[model samples]
Target chain A: MPQLDPTSFSPQLFWLAIAFILLYLLMSRLVLPRVGKVLGQREERIQGNLEKAVKLKAEAEEVLAAYQKSIADARAEAHSALNQAAAEIAAATAAREADFARKLAEQTAVAESRIKVSKTQALADIRTVAGDLAAAMTSKLTGVTVNGSDAGGAVEAVLKERA
Target chain B: MAAEHHSPLEQFRVEHIGGNLSLGGYDISFNNSALWMLIAVAAITVFMLVGIRKQAVVPGRWQALVEFLYDFVANMLKENVGNEGRKYFPWVFSIFMFVLFCNLFGLLPNSFTVTSHIIVTFALALMVFIIVTAIGFIRHGLHFLSFFVPKGAPAWLLPLMIPIEIISYFIRPMSLSVRLFANMVAGHVMLVVLGSFVLPLGLAGAYISGIVPVAAITAIIGLEFLIACLQAYVFTILTCIYLNDAVHMNH
Candidate 1:
């Protein structure tokens, strides 16, 4: 075979050495370093982006938590305010009712006292009218005149006997 | 071309190109093999350099391909030789790309296959052998000689084991070189021999009969392509394994 012919061997080796050395130099110096750098940079960028995403998500979560807490606080404040207003209204209603009752009691007591005095006056007036009528009737019918005291004493004795 | 008597061996010829020249008593005449090697180198350079011209964060298809090959070799070295093997990446990558492109280019019709030549393959294997051995010695001093000694063998068994180990270790270059050379030579020879039959068959019988060998050649060509890739991978991976052995003896 032509391959076994020793004459061709050295030249082949020579060219191979040159080609191989050239390739090694190119790859080691030029190609591989750049490729590695690019890959490393991409990886770093990806990692940075991931970290940023995580940070943003955490911030969002914090804001949500704060928002929920504020909502709860507002609800609690509103409830307390409503309770306080209701309590105040109840207290005012109770005070107003007590004042009205006290006033009504005072007016009721005055009216009762006035009715008692009127009742006594009406009784006195009735007694006088009865006395005069009795005196006038006796004089006209039997021609007997009676004094006020005599008639009063007679009415009292009759009133006392029937009592 | 059809009128000429065809010899399948003609393809293996390495005729002088440009002119005959000698350097230091060796007839280092430029030949097709030399041209092809330069072509392979140029192709590799362009593939890598142009691919990364953009150096994009998100790679385009060409850049992705380049990166994929880079990662493939890098991972192989890592898996085989661990972290210390990192320094050897350039050499391994160059070897892989060089062999791959040469094999692929050789598949072109009427092309001279560099790897098919025994001397070329032997040279590559020798290069690997020398590097691996040198590394072993440099790292471990004379302790590298202990590589031939079996780890757990009985003292009596070692007498037999050591020489055998030595022999097997030395056989590496031959095995590595011949494997690549034989595969390439056989494949090309078979292709040419079958191809020579095509015109005769077509002229002798119905033209349709010629399609049989043609179909076979087509299938085998496909297989050859696969073999080319596989061989390149094998060559590189074997280099890694050898490097592993040298870098860490016995374990």
Candidate 2:
């Protein structure tokens, strides 16, 4: 086989060097930046999503707390209203009962007074009729003048003897 | 193997130059290897320039094909190097394209495989080694030397450890060049030897014997084509890994 050596400082090394430099430039200036940009974009997107999730979670917790508080306030208000209504009903019923009892007592007292006045008037009318009958009998029998007072006393004495 | 006819290597033989020029030291004789190298370089330049000359948004077939290769190498760099290390894409891309073109050009009928030569492959490997080393030193200086030292080794094992590191470092270029050259040479030789047998076997035997050599040649040629692409890929990827080691020094 023949020896396979090239002359030193040939165009071969120059071409190789040129190619290497060109390759290095293309990589550094063009290709590398695109790749790096893509990766950086991806990382930013992931981090943004994470932060959004955290914010949403905080907002949800706040809403839940507010809802719970409102429900508790409503329940307390309902209980207070129910208590007030019950107390009002009890007071009204007690007042009605007291009024009814007072009216009944006044009606009973008026009836009892009317019965006593009627009985007194009836007894007075009976006494006058008896006195008139005594006076007429004394005048006829004695054929003499008799006083009104003497007649009245004789009638009362006769009635007492008959009882 | 037979004296009846010539071998395929005959075409690649170096002939003596009888020119009167006093360029004594200059081996003005052109061989198969040099022809293929020029062809590879031309093929790459023409393919890329022609493919993107139109610069169409919706690219043609040639443009699409070229673009695919571009994107492929770009993605390979990004995947290996990560975000911070993506700055070296141009160097990696050019290496991949040039090597790929060289390997593919050799696959053509009667074309020489320059990568099959150890000197050519060594030059490629040497460039990678030198560039990566320089980059490492520039980036980390003496700190880059720490890449050779294993973190978990015992103090007593420094003697064994240091030698292993040195050997491993030296073997990088050797392994890188040899792997490419050997694979390319072996594939080409197999195809040529098998193809030569086809003609000799055809003339000496019955017509039916032609089928065997034909089938074998076809299979070997197909495998060679595949290998051409694979060897280029292997060469490019290894260079990337070596560059990564220099840049990051992860170990």
True contacts kept of each: 0.79, 0.13
Can you tell me which runs of candidate 2 are displaced by over 4 Å? A1-163, B1-5, B11-32, B54-60
Cα lDDT tens digits for candidate 1, B1-251: 65333667678878888877888998888999999999999999999989988999999999999999999999999999999999999999999999999999999977789999999999999999999999999999999999988888899999999999999999999999999999999999899988988988988898887888899899999999998888999999999999999999855
lDDT of 1 by residue, A1-163 (tens): 8899899988898899999999999999999998888889989999999999999999999999999999999999999999999999999999999999999999999998898888888766666666777787888887899867677777777778998
Report the C-alpha displacement of residue B134, candidate 1, in angstroms. 1.1
DockQ of each: 0.58, 0.09
Q: List the residue pairs that clash in candidate 1.
A: none
Q: Relative to the true structure, how large is the alpha-carbon lDDT of every model? A: 0.91, 0.70
Query: Using Cα atoms with residue i matched to residue i, what is each candidate's TM-score against the true structure?
Result: 0.81, 0.61
For each candidate in turn, the interface RMSD (Å) is 0.8, 6.0
Off by over 4 Å in 1: A90-163, B1-5
Judged by DockQ cut-offs, is candidate 1 incorrect, acceptable, medium or high? medium
Query: TM-scores for chain B, in order?
Result: 0.97, 0.88
